[model samples]
Structures are given as structure tokens and as C-alpha cells.
Target: MSEAVDWGLALATGVRTASSGPEMSMTEAAAEVAALREAAAAVVEPVAGITALSAPEAPPAVVVDRAEWIRSNAGALRTVLTPLTDGERQVGGFAQPVSSRLAGLQLGLALGWLSGKVLGQYEALPAESDGPQRLLLVAPNIVQAATVMGVDEHDFRLWVCMHEETHRVQFGAHPWLSEYFAGEVAALVRGLDVGPAELAARLASGIRNADSGGVAGWLQSPQMRSRMSGLMALMSLLEGHADWVMDQSEEVVPSAARLRVAFEQRRRGGGLFDAVLRRLLGLDAKLAQYREGAAFTRAVIDQVGLSGFNKVWSGPATLPLAGEINDSTAWVARVRSM
Candidate 1:
């Protein structure tokens, strides 16, 4: 897998003029990463309770510190999950490595972070790029991955490498992937024009009593319901496929299921104080929908089988709209007929 590669020194640099537009500058990416690191540290350091985790074989103090820093942030890390969202903010677990046993417990989160970051970055790729657009930010925990996954650092690195490389491969193979996803997201954002009465009413009601987490919450208005539906539909397919790819490989990794279940529980459990969602995205749109999306994808896989499920990803036009997920049998037949 170590083919021709760039150390990514210039990779994180600001987005120069690409076909899409000006990409985020490296400086901006760094600042963003720094801010997230601080956020991750803030969450983890407090959890440490002043006593460092006493491992039989801890690395040097600095390595441990870096590892702990990433771990602490693992539970609360947040930023763009997908390129569809601006800044593509998502939590940091995908970039950080935890113990392999712990890896399963956190799979949902890692997938959430990974799926969003990887796919979001893919979607954010500017028009006509030669390869995977440079990552504005990458979160990698050299020490954590080794300890958590019971794998060599290089192997763990390969895991992340695969995630990033998949973005490149998917986009390269199907150039329209990013555009289709981003367009749906932009549509949702555009649909989110709060009405004067609703905005005024929301203001009058005071922020504390807001339907902040509901579908009609601050970030997700009724108007944007269609956008939410469409975005979820798209996300379900993308993430479903990514998770399947990661889970299906028997040769490379054997414990993906354990990791996935653990991760799903964490995702379902919601954040401590439920602050992780609000602090990161200015919304809690993901907390509820992720499980639903997972189920939807699993249902598709079960009903259609891998080949049929994989076939769904052949093109953007074939993808199900928000309406099709609830009634997938109809679409399954439609897919089969076509």
C-alpha cells in the first residue's frame, strides 16, 4: 500500500483555486485542527481525574500524553462528519486510535467520524482535481491505534490510509460522487431559511425552551425536512457501503464486528451531558439519525444481498430519495426491475 505518496506537508495547505472554488487554506486547516485538539483535550483531560492510566507498558510520557489527548477527545470530539456540511466538522475518533477491544465499542463513533470526515472530504473535493483532494486536517493517533487494535503502528496507519484512499478511489472511479452528495447538503442548507414568524417566535420563547434536539429544533426546521431526508438517504448509502467494505475484509482484520457493536452502543448512548453534539455541530441532527441510517442500510443489505446492495451505489441517479428508505421493498423491486 505504500506506493508513491506525499508526506502531506503541502496537503493540508489552503485550498488553492480548484474547479470547485478556493479550498480551505492549510493555515485554516491547522487552526481548525488546533481548536479541535483543544476541544478534545478539554474533554479527555478532565476525564483523566488527575491520575494517569497506569498501563503495564506505557510509552514515553510524551507519547502517552499524545495518546491520552486523543483518547480524551475520542468521546467528545466533534467536527464536520461529511463534506456536505460546511467545514465538514466532525468528532475526532476516526483519526485517533484507541485499544483494539475499545475500538469495537467506539466503532459507531469512529465510523461516524470516519464516514463523515472521509466522505465529507470526498464531497468537498473541488471540481477536476487529479486525485484525492488534500485533507484540510487529519487526526491520527500512532500510539492509540497500536494499543487499541492490537496491531502494529503501520497496520493501524494502513486502516486510516485505507479510509483516505477509499475517498480517492471512490471519487476517481465515479467523479460525480462528491457533487451529488454536496449538492444535496447545499439544498438542505438553502432550505433552512427560518421564517420571520418562526424566527421571532423562537427568539421570543427564549433559547432554553427551544426544541433544540427535535426535527423542528433550532438547526432542523420543518422547512428543511426534505433536505434532512435527502441528506440522510445519501449518507445511509455512502456510510453503509463504507462500513460494509471495512467489515467484509476477513484477511486484513477479523474483529470488525466486535468493534462495530461497541461503536454503535456509544453512538446510541448519546454524549455525556449531551453536549458533544451541540458543541460540535450547533445541532444534534446526527445523534438520532445515525442509528436509523444504519438500520436502513442493514435492511437493504439483508433484502438485496451484498451484490444488490452494492449495485445501489452504481450511480447517483439510482440512489433512493428520502421517500424510498421507509418503503424500501418498492424501491428494491424497482432496482431489480431496472
Candidate 2:
């Protein structure tokens, strides 16, 4: 595996980066898992009203701590990124022996800290599953968010589930989405022509000059952004759709606004260290996905209504182009012309 396997070190260090936090008792974790499952059931019909997709498979909800959450996801990340890593390995010597070790440390620390921010994830592994996919909820993070927001624990937990279950339905109903997303990811990784050392040095340079240029300055070059655009658009659509569905779930939580406020606040106030990690790790892009995507979704739904909006799910081709995400009218107009 060597230093070429930066993700391996990333897992080790990433978990370290995020606070594992105080462990929840087994009983507490189990109870939260059950509550999340219940929330999924309650939300299905209402969420269906928002989108054409349905939760056909009643996947089990998993409640895990920060360490376990990272552990479980690491295997999947490895599977997806291994090809790219191997490709980088071919361009050897450009990366120093210490470079891989340092990258590993950085990755691990980043993940460890990120554990607190992640509320839930839909881990897709159709090859391993005979029944249905798994919905992972980081128990500690959920607890932390609830406490931080001063909201009802159950209400907050359910709110998190709505977003995840919507994710499950989107991927589950549209198997093509899984393949398309993976293909995009693989293409990006395979296209990389540098080793960890060179990449890190560039990233360090990017960070230094990034302040003047802002996110555009150091985060991505023109080619990188073009390559990432389609993936970004897809992510925006999925996340924004989930956010829209969660909001449409008016009956699920009475104080949705406060819940939103709490999460928004949670993303901020990370201190200088946290800010650097977020930029280095590309988390800023992730946070922006929620805002941009939700806005696109809202604009489309307002213009087309739920039934009309279903056209997006009709096929991969119907999905919005990268530029359309920022301009809702363009997406709506494009869909209409089709």
C-alpha cells in the first residue's frame, strides 16, 4: 500500500482529525437507529409528494460513532479511488517519501474532525447487499447537533433522516445515477497525472495564494473546474432535491426553521485551523452544494410543479447541465424545450 495509498492514511488520520467524541451507549445508538428508521417510514409518502422517486426498499438505518463511520466509509472510498492512486504511483519520485506520510496525516486529521459535521450518509454497496442499501447515521454527530442546536433530539434525528432517505430513493430508484456518478469520479481520478508530493505542494501553493483569489484562486484551476462541473451539477441536484423534500416535510417537524438555523451555525465558527482544513479538504465546495442546489430545486419546482419536475429523473440526459445549476430558468427552459 505504501505512501501511494494516501486514503489509507487518510482514514487513520481523518478519524483522528475529527473528534470521535464520547461514545454513545449501545442502547442509545440502537434507539436512535430505530428512531431514524421510523422517521424514514413517516417521510416516504410526504417526500413522494415532492418527487417522483419512492423508497421501494426499506433499508435498515445504521447508527455509528465517528470512528466506525469513517471506518465503514473508508473501504468504499478506497474501492473508488484505488485506480487513481495506482495511476499516481506510476508518476513516482515526484512525491517524496515524507510527502505520502504527511498527506496521510493530513487526510486522517481532516476526516477525524469531519466526523462531527456529517449527520448522515447513504452508503451504496449493491454488490454486497441482498436486501437493500444501508443508511448510516453518525450517532455522536447527531447527538452533538441536537445538543448544539438545543432542539428536540427526536425531531432533529428525524430531520436528518429525511435528507438521507431522500438520497437513498434518488440513488435506489435511479441505478443509473450510481454508475454515472462513479464514472465521473473515476474519470477525474484517472485523469490525475501527479503524485501526492507534487499535488500537496501545489495545494500548499494554492492555499497561500488562495486568499487573494478567494475560492476560485486556489481551489481549482480552469481545467479542474471544467472536469468537476458535471459532477458538481449532479451533486447540487441531488442535495438540493433532498433539502427541498425535507422542507416540504412540514408535518415531520414543527420547528424546521430552527433546525436549519442550528445546522447553518454548526457549519461556521470552526476557528482558523478548521477553516484551513475545510479549504484544503474541499469541504467549502460541499457546503456550497447545499445552497446552490436547493436554490435550483426551489426555482424549478416553483415554475414546473412536482409532476413537471419529475422529468429530471426521467433519464440521465434530462439532468441539468453544469451551467444550468446557477440559472434555474435555463434548466426549466431547457427541460421545456425537450
For residue 44, what is the lDDT in candidate 2?
Answer: 66
Poorest stretch of ten by lDDT in candidate 2: 269-278
lDDT of 2 by residue, 1-338 (tens): 45444666767776666665646687976776677667757766666666767656665676767887667655554554456456446465533556666765554554565567677777653323243457777777777778867888877877888888788889878888777776765665555555544454434333333232223333345675565666667777887788887787658777777787777776531212223323443544336766888888888888988777778887777898888888988988888888
Across residues 50-144, which tens digit of lDDT does each residue of candidate 1 receive?
11111122111111122222232232212111221222222222222232223223322332233222111222323223332332213333233
By TM-score, the best candidate is 2
Query: At residue 217, what lDDT does model 1 achieve?
Result: 50
The TM-score of predicted model 2 comes to 0.80
Instruction: Looking at model 1, report the run of 10 residues with the lowest lDDT sum.
Output: 1-10
Off by over 4 Å in 1: 1-132, 135-155, 161-164, 194-224, 261-295
